[model samples]
Target: MNFHELLLCEGNTLEKEKGEHVFMQGDSDKSLYFIQTGLLKAYYTSSSGKEAIKSFILPNDFIGSLSSIYAGQNCSFSLVSLETSMLVKIPFEKIVEYGKKDIVLANNIIEFLMRLTLKKERREHEFLCMSAEERYLALIESTPILLKKITQNDLARYLGMTPVGLSRIKKRVQSKMSKQGENNP
Candidate 1:
């Protein structure tokens, strides 16, 4: 069964409106959430109050304070819905209980966490190696759906660029594609 199905079997679900916070930075709650519908963003706020988006969680994505759960500390980031969303809220204690009894469920959770970790590592490498334009282009190529769903400001923050920079990159890429299409046709 899929992650959603697993969560449905074991967790409590809730509906959240756009702009609602699932959890805030420094929150002590260690609940794990699986998105049933819509989108959410995880972000970190610096002491100077600048926000940096960590990731966009889509349907079936698992999110929570994994590090905090393991370390027994407060959550390090904040989670907020980008649209009206449905989520399965699984308490950390429940996960532990399920893991102890269900090998398949435990393995699936491990795989999911590993995939998330790899994706984060890849994004870090891309940020370190790619130019602003290249990063935007790569994101568009890899996750075109995000272009339709996310706000320009949020997208820019996720890409580690300014809104103006993202705009310029989009215009440039569009112009380049248009020119290439015309020449090919």
Candidate 2:
């Protein structure tokens, strides 16, 4: 079954504004939220008073349910709407009952979790292996739409770079692209 149908069957839609939180770290782990529209970022603040992004969720993606899958654990990450977003919140009991009743739904949920995990892992790896410029380019190449939607500061934080460093990289990338265009012309 499709996402809307699933939501229609057993979930409620929530509307939230940009900068509003869907869930915070240490909140109850009783529900799974699916993004029907817009975006959400999962993050955690360190003891050093730093915020590190864990993952970004776009439309048709799931968030916050991972910690609940194995056992009901306190939220390990904060989920904030990056834009005014629409989310379908499904309670754990509803999903568990639905999964038991329908194999296809269970399979879909499993696949969704696996997809999210893989993407999160890739993001972590990029932070480790890619230079700031490379990571920035990769993000741009993958989600050019986000360039207009999110602030450079958030982008810098997501890429694990300082905002000033991001500014320098942005200028360099722009200059390089402009020169390439001139040369080609």
Best by TM-score: 1
Q: TM-score per candidate, in order? A: 0.89, 0.85
Give lDDT tens digits, candidate 2, residues 13-65: 99999999987887776877878898888888787878877767889777764
TM-score of candidate 2 relative to the true fold:
0.85
Which ranges of candidate 1 are over 4 A from the true structure?
Answer: 1-6, 179-185
* lDDT by residue (tens digit), candidate 1, 24-106: 99988778888889999999998999888989999978889866888888888999999999998988787778777878878
Model 2: weakest 10-residue lDDT segment is: 63-72
Candidate 2: lDDT over CA atoms?
0.82
Task: Judge candidate 1 at residue 118 and give its lDDT.
Answer: 97
lDDT (Cα, 0-100) at 105 in candidate 1:
74
